[model samples]
Target: MTAAVPTVSDAEAAVILARCDELARHSSLTDGIERTYLSAEHAAVNYRVAGWMTAAGLTTWQDAAGNQCARLSGSTRGLPALMLGSHLDTVRAAGRYDGILGVLVAIAVAGRIAASGRPLPFALEIAAFGDEEGTRFGTTLLGSRAVAGTWLESWWDLRDAGGVSLREAFLAFGLDPAKVGDAARAPQELLGYLEAHIEQGPVLEEEGRALGVVTGIAGARRFLLTVTGSAGHSGTPWPRRRDALAGAAEGITTIERIARAEGLTATVGHLRVFPDAVNVIPGKVEFSLDLRAPDDADRDRGWTLIESALTDICGTRGLDLASTQVHEAAAVACSPRLRAAIATGIRSTEPTTAPADAARPDEGGSDSGPEAPADDAPRELPSIAGHDAMAIAAITDVGMLFVRCAGGISHHPDESVTAADVALAVDALEAAVRALAADYPAL
Candidate 1:
């Protein structure tokens, strides 16, 4: 049997919040956070995280892929590790706690376990992945991909907004580009991975819960769609004009309609129209399509429906349609054993003040306060956003814990999490570690 999980004191919660604030100060933006991979800010954050890792009683190192990693031994020397951590990178103008909280929570878990002085069957490892957002190079999960042994040779040529290649950035950051392959780990070397992250959506908050267990990460497919027609004077008669912009407008509306009807999330975030002048008819229109679903087959079906609709619309408008898929990432399902462990952890950390269930209309519901449900059934939801765990899933089983974020907002400066929630998350994470040790004593 495993030992009792440690209680997360107020002091520990304060330290985690303080560390998050400190990391926020190292961002490229003065007004907001923007720490990209391999940038100067990236190096600074890694150095500080390494110091924290050592303080937590773990040996530290910066892996070849630029991830700051630390590990604590278990019952024996050189045992396969159970990895716990999240990405340390952020999007442009990002919030302070999205990925940072997960890494700090992992460190706290390790520290608490180390303080107990109880040996385990597998090693406890923390990996602060360097690049999960891919904001700098337009390719996500670079750090996790390397560790998963799925690094692609084409990534070296990818360029940043400043025209710097990934290879060049690695050299400038003092990482040997040629040694990047060394970051890869065989599946046999790891037991599994666990990440605790903010929900980045309104589900938990809406449900009046502080925590939830992730069911899976959504699979995503991105496409570049273009509509072509002949440009003409604005004065041209409508019957003679083949307006691509009009068709694009119709296409966008149809995309939203199809997504809503199909129960998927589809976004057309970027759009460009040629001859952008107000007095000229647009000859061409281009837009980006990002579609995500909880399952691969579902997502593919939605895409097919979307494509068919767009094609028909464009044809009706006498416009030519073209599309190319730029990126695709498969969905990742969490490990069932780890999922149960997390659920158990949530129950262990349940606050006495939890209010009534929000699902029941008779229950008085308020978005501002936590609602304790009548049952111990922790809500399980799939992550609509991408994460490092999705990449690491290529190598080992993975699980995630979702903490409620204020307003379900992320990737923005306003992103926020309550101190009470953080405290609860730490408690849950510590319990999860203990539960894992008990269930998988043989590693």
Candidate 2:
């Protein structure tokens, strides 16, 4: 059996929380946190966090993509690393813990591991990804994607709100655009990737648990939908009017209905109508559709049905229907190897709250969990929100731990987590890393 994982002290927990507040100060928004890619805010946080990593006993450096990274050599001369981390960027007006908590927790965990002086078979590394939220450039996971060797050449042309192209921003940030590829890591360089993030949902809190296991991430697709019709007088006869807005309203409602019935997550978040004159009937409408599902086949099927419904809605309204696909990502499941290790970590720590009875094999976790967890097993669920792990999945096996966030709130200033939970999470994360290290004995 694996040795019992150590629990973190409250003082350690307090330090992690304090660093989050300090990180918030680097934001551009005085009222709320808003750190973007390649901004001064980004550089500030990288420099600050790199200092913390060094104090934690790791060799620190910034990658070509501007991500903050640190490493501790293994007992052997060379070996692929057991990686840990999460992104540091936040959405505009974001809550404090969304991505911030994960990085801080990783640092604290690294500190504990380094202080122990335990020998490991694999090196340990931490990655504080720079641009997971994508608030500035309108593209998510830019930092992790670049590191995964999936960076698209066309992204250089992508511009921020200030009209600064990504290539130009790279120069301003003092990163060589041509050398960005140097950040990419081959599969052999990393044994696996692990991330700890706020639940960003109420599942664990609602269940009175401080942490949970993430089974997989939802697959997502986004589209720009347009409906076109002829302009007409406001008094036009009902049968003669090809009202694009009316059709769009129906389409939005239909999307919600289908999403509900098909078990998908769909939203018509943005909508615009042309010909805004009070007297003239609107002739064109444009809307954004964000569709997601537990898996690729489910998402694709729901999209097909929604598309067919929109076609029929427009056909009946005498309007034309068109759609442009903008973004797509396949569902990614946690690696069984890493999942078991995380489960071990969680099991080794006592639950913050009592569970009704000893948790059986089926009480929590994915159906494929290797074994039953402890008496108060961590709740298991899927993540609907995207993460840097999704991008990293392209290069190596991935796993994630979700700490409870108050009220399931994220992307707002009200996001919150408890010190007790943070301490538990820190312990769980460190234990997981230790478990992975034990798997490969020192050379």
Residue 432 displacement in candidate 1 (angstroms):
0.8
TM-score of each: 0.92, 0.91
Q: How close is candidate 2 to the true structure, as a TM-score?
A: 0.91
* lDDT per residue (tens digit) for residues 137-191 in model 1: 9888999999998999999999998899999999999999899999998999898
What C-alpha lDDT do the candidate models reach, one value each? Answer: 0.89, 0.86
lDDT of 2 by residue, 216-310 (tens): 99999999999999889999999899999999999999999999999999988788888877888889999999999879999999999999999
What would the TM-score be for candidate 1 when compared with the true structure? 0.92
Worst 10-residue lDDT window for candidate 1 reads 353-362
Q: What is every candidate's alpha-carbon RMSD to the true fold?
A: 5.0, 6.1
